[model samples]
Target: MPEKIDYLKKIRELTQEYFQISLDDIPIPETELVNIEPDRADGLLVGSKEALNYQYLVQGDITPFLNKAPEGYFLIGFWGHGFNSYGFYYSRVEPNSRIFFRLPYGGAYMNNKREAIRIKNFLINFFEFKNKLKTATTFNVVESMGEGFHEIKYKDQTVKFKGSVYRQRNPEKHFQKILKSLKVPTKRHQHIIKLPSWAGKKYEDMTPKEQEEYQEHLRRKFTWEPGDLKKVGHEPLTEDEKKLVESIKKQEEDVNKE
Candidate 1:
């Protein structure tokens, strides 16, 4: 119980800092009983390594909190399927429950296109994944999608998708297959950071200066360079090169005139 609370504190703090939140103006989570031996819900099993302690409570447990959340504050919920292929991946934060921003793993697409884009922008700014995020949004970032995904009523409007979403096709069947044994950053969390703890100290906690490293890391992870092979690679000529080309063209013109 204490562990889950502490974990939530760390996650919230990190997320706040990640988003450059000046104040504690965010969703307050409500949790469920999970420490009970042999938890059957498996709600807690779908998050990233850092969220292991709270996964048991993530699934259905957030409803009470959402129901009570004040308007204007977005509700965020976390829950997942199977043993966690990526253990976690990007989740669509929809505004279906006027209560809070539901971050549930099994959540459907957002219906309000404009509002969805607005919320996504805020989240992208908050998560700092704006650079690495590869969403399906075309005209609006919310509508565009990628491969391996399904189309459903995001909120009010109907959405069609050609490729299925990445999360819908996580290959790893069990956590063991996808889990990466990680080392907790320092002695601070030695006691709390146990086996299932993966992201004890990752990009989530990186300070602004430290975030540069993460930014660079993301740039490399999704590295791409502009290319136009069909169009002959055009290089701007220097003044001297430009003069030489012009002179050649002028000489050709002179010959043709003759």
Candidate 2:
């Protein structure tokens, strides 16, 4: 626990130095854990009559249903802990994926206090960064500060068909539309708990181009791991990503000036 606390402390220091956001604008969670699970408690997710973003700024660390974290990020906020550029409060303080890679290793703790010499580790792994830098760089957040959706696009790379059949991974809801039209079947699917009146429409209702675009723009809505895309080669930077990174850097410089 002591080492975990130290690593968390270190995370805060680096975030403050590079995130370039005003600390006052982003308050920290009082502790590493939320007062309670937001979903389990009423009003935790909906909050008061304040703006959704304002509520998150005031109490996001405890809410999960309304969370808009960077794609592929675990963001310790679930446990009320903050790391990298994230504050425990759930606000996207300095939304940079690079902040996640900044941790010395990863996870809640490093080592256990007991054991002769080996001292077994927790988190099911040693709680270290094996390839956090590489993985973190493969994705970026759409915004550093937003009370809205935390949109994320996965970095894509072109791969030649080498005649080796590749197993498929789960695709996003929009992409599933394409598969549905193609008559492909899958046990897994994007589950929408709530359905609006328009939900009555089926995949046949979508135009071909719309379906294709949805599939083409597919992205990850969950965490990333080395095994997930280990074989995918490097992707050339998309024009949008290049621009976003530049804008982030500019903001960093501006914050440094202050």
Candidate 3:
């Protein structure tokens, strides 16, 4: 197990080195560090909340931390149980030598999967830019949802396909076709809207004009929903599903009333 004292010391050392400020300079009150257990892998770090807020200010907004980070820098956060936290680390040298700094109450208000996906996507894009300034960088997304784990990788050219889980080792051939269809000058947004699995069959059966209309319909509806179009594409919500959504919305309102 990691020692609380050791982790706190390391955090202080890292913050001083990266931000050029001692732990005392941070805005979070010292008393907040009391419950942090360094030895535990999952426990929060002392002063992490303050450090994260400071980083956002220094970096000129969360974009740098959210998108492609420069080489020698990375952001880490914890998410689960109705909150998301933020923090950043940077390397002074390679191989086990780095600095870690955190922000205060970083996880306080955020609590949802959509928010998590948006944050993660932004960070991945940022990292992609940083990696590309050198040689081409390989982009990978890994998901570990308790029961299963999956990973997908894409080359620099394919970064346009933003949220896709399909790994394309050679995405060049289909690049132009995808670009023309999506009507976007940048490839980075490809993963943003995924066609349903049944889209192929449905698209094939329809006339060219029908396909165009269908594609346009989807372009206007820009929300994220899992499963291919065959299951839950651009079709209107079912009456039952709509009622469930309404019910949940009312429940939310009732909770807010209290």
Name the candidate that leads on TM-score: 1
In angstroms, give how far residue 151 of model 1 lies from its true place: 2.5
Estimated TM-score per prediction? 0.22, 0.17, 0.21
Q: What's the residue-level lDDT of 202 in candidate 2?
A: 42
**Residues 1-258 of candidate 3: C-alpha lDDT, one tens digit per residue:** 964355556666755454444545432322333223333235434333333333322223333433443333333323122344333322111122222222222345634333334333333443333333233233233212211111112332443333222123232333334434434344364556877543545445677776556555544543334332223355676554454344545565689799
Model 1, total clashes: 25
Q: Please tell me which model should have the higher TM-score, number 2 or number 3.
A: 3
Candidate 2: misplaced stretches above 4 Å?
22-24, 31-64, 67-258
Q: Which candidate, 1 or 2, has the higher TM-score?
A: 1
Task: List ranges where model 3 is wrong by over 4 Å.
Answer: 1-106, 135-258
- Each model's C-alpha lDDT? 0.32, 0.29, 0.37
Report the lDDT tens digits of candidate 1 across residue range 116-200.
3433344434333222212323111121122232232322333434432222323222111211221111224445634322223
**lDDT of residue 164 for candidate 2:** 8
